[model samples]
Target: MTWIHLLSKSHIPFSVYKMYKGDSLIQPKTIKNTHILVILQGILSMYHVLNKTEVICNSIVYTGHIITSNDSDYTYNYISLRTSYIISLPITTTDLNQYIDHKIFNQILYNYNNTLKQNIDINRIFIHKNIKFRLIQIIIILSMKFGIIHNQKIMIPLIIHKIDLANILGGNINTINKILKDLDDQKIVTYAKRNIYVHNIVFLKYYCYLLR
Candidate 1:
């Protein structure tokens, strides 16, 4: 269990929130404070609409992960990709002093922030011109998020929508479809009924080298 779950069960200044699919989390006129959330159930997506026709998906927050937002980061509307439950907690200087084990708690916070930083940096793949590289990057990100290794293949536990993946990767639907089909044909990955299973981690992980 994560720190947020510990905080919730121990009654350490946290609240469990339930959000349904398509519910708006932040309004256009809303200004929020610095806070953190732990997704307990489903995925939460942050997106912004521009000029009534353009929609940009900024990020997708998954289950068992922490999401933090400050004033500058709350510009997009955060919506539930599916029905989700989350834990919301404030993280003030005073709150830090209240932790029962500040050292471990501090370490947890540090580690989570580091992962968040990596997530932000890796998301730049959306700008890459190579669709193959872009899809590989997305797969790496998802593998880290929800992968379970079994019999040499890494399988994501959730049923991920290919359309959502296309939006996230900043690629056309047809391109994503083609790449996925090719991957399946090449035995590098297996995609069926919205489920993604990686057959060769070594082969799949090779594309991540381009990032460096």
Candidate 2:
């Protein structure tokens, strides 16, 4: 995926939504109102039992158009593959009509829609390489968004685990562990108590290039 555009602001009311691992915020049950979900941080997975499908992070799900489970007994899980930040757009039909008619908002939406439609094919043979590239890109973007000055280190406070990393990278736990160990050995990162201290951001970026 490429940085097609960045949305610094939104006309709609934006809330910093957060979810923990294994937490179910939106059950399978459908809501009458419309909502737009934008993944700002972290990763989440949505499983559609009816369609036997699952969607991973960086996916925009339109709740109004999708039919999900309505059974009260049906339990839908919104697992946080990792700690996540999401923007929820809560708008009624009338609100949507007015919002969509705005030229600026429409243009932003159009570009994102087009970007979503572009196909980026991946193969198993090259999956690891692709994942490393994507993760490194994500790290850079997050650094821009949330980096902090800690002992002169550009540290990201998010406590990400191996399982979460695996989910985000579309790799398995073993692969993530190996990568983390390699980085640890190189003194690029130090992991303790779920906290990842990036000792050398420059070297990390360089390692990402090596993978490429």
Candidate 3:
């Protein structure tokens, strides 16, 4: 089931809006409306702009994410990585608490838990690994989430810049450049024409020896 399914019985008021590429889904400031932001379509990336650099807070949110500001202060900034559709539904903690004991809520909880597990996996994969290994592992994770297979190669949906990759990896641009070079040299992955294509998954997996 999808978020739409969960919202079917919801009488809470909502407003749907289209966000083009480069639009802000949520600004870094407090909001009067305690609305739950839902990704209706396409991919969205959560980012924090620090010292004029975009630090990735979350990987591409594929779907089923409910962006909420339960606290009084809200400052999470979300940007459209691709053209996307989104809706803001006004909700309260009381309203959410009421649904906590249902089967539908359990399924939603599972989805959130799955996303948490992916983050944990990423942290583990990147920790203490060399730049080349971390770079390859990240490509594998992105491929699993957003890749399309063609000619036995995996094509990811978005343009991947070295800086963006660096931000995701928590590394410097020069290091990411070096790692990208190594990945290309090893035939593990390559980013070109605003897209990343994984050339060989089986060989890449062997290189990473993914334990999970």
Candidate 4:
């Protein structure tokens, strides 16, 4: 699918494509165009070549984030998912400048620029709490967008791995393991293999402070 077809009315010029493992996706060279990835399913990891850092896992990359390709020669990077639906917008700086609100865009641009300036540790502490909030937000957004399949109970085809959660939460593998164990102890979630069974969504909402 093309960006025109996905976002039919928006004047944003983009192209949409489905990618899987070994698809020869773009390697990590910087480009003038902006890409937005809305994950329909599966997982993905973005790695920064210059710093040798992985930005986030299973993250839905939006307009605000800056990324580098794993390969230097190409304008794209490899996606670490079995399958993903992605939209690439061939946008000029002028087009982006006009579309994005100036203040927010400036802030994002500043952050991206700063990120490129130094070697960033993937396990930084400055954004720990904010990272948790964002991870929960992603869950809420996915819940609303894709919803759950009805059976004797409600289930979502959550194909996420522990390492992926650690990346998204900006924590270590052991930390994520602890968190999942805590959640399991509370009976809010159950996991088997790579699938997460949300047994108690309401309880989870309260536990995560999304509800009171």
Query: Global CA lDDT of candidate 1, please?
Result: 0.70
Ranking by lDDT: 1, 3, 2, 4
Residue-level lDDT tens digits of model 2 in 47-115: 333333653432212211121223454444455645665555545677566544355356546645543
lDDT of 2 at 190: 61
Candidate 1: regions farther than 4 A off:
2-11, 19-24, 27-29, 40-43, 48-51, 79-84, 91-108, 150-152, 207-212
Clashing pairs in 2: none
Predictions in order: lDDT: 0.70, 0.52, 0.66, 0.50
Each prediction's RMSD to truth: 3.7, 7.9, 3.9, 8.2
Model 2 misses residue 160 by how many Å? 1.2
The per-candidate count of clashes, in order, stands at 0, 0, 0, 6
Instruction: Report the candidate with higher TM-score, 1 versus 4.
Output: 1
My TM-score estimates for the predictions, one after another, are 0.74, 0.55, 0.74, 0.54
Q: Which stretches of candidate 2 lie over 4 Å from their true place?
A: 1-18, 25-33, 38-93, 97-135
- Output the lDDT of residue 98, model 1: 72
- TM-score, structure 1 vs. true: 0.74
lDDT for model 2 comes to 0.52
Candidate 4 segments exceeding 4 Å error: 1-16, 21-30, 34-50, 53-82, 87-137, 210-212
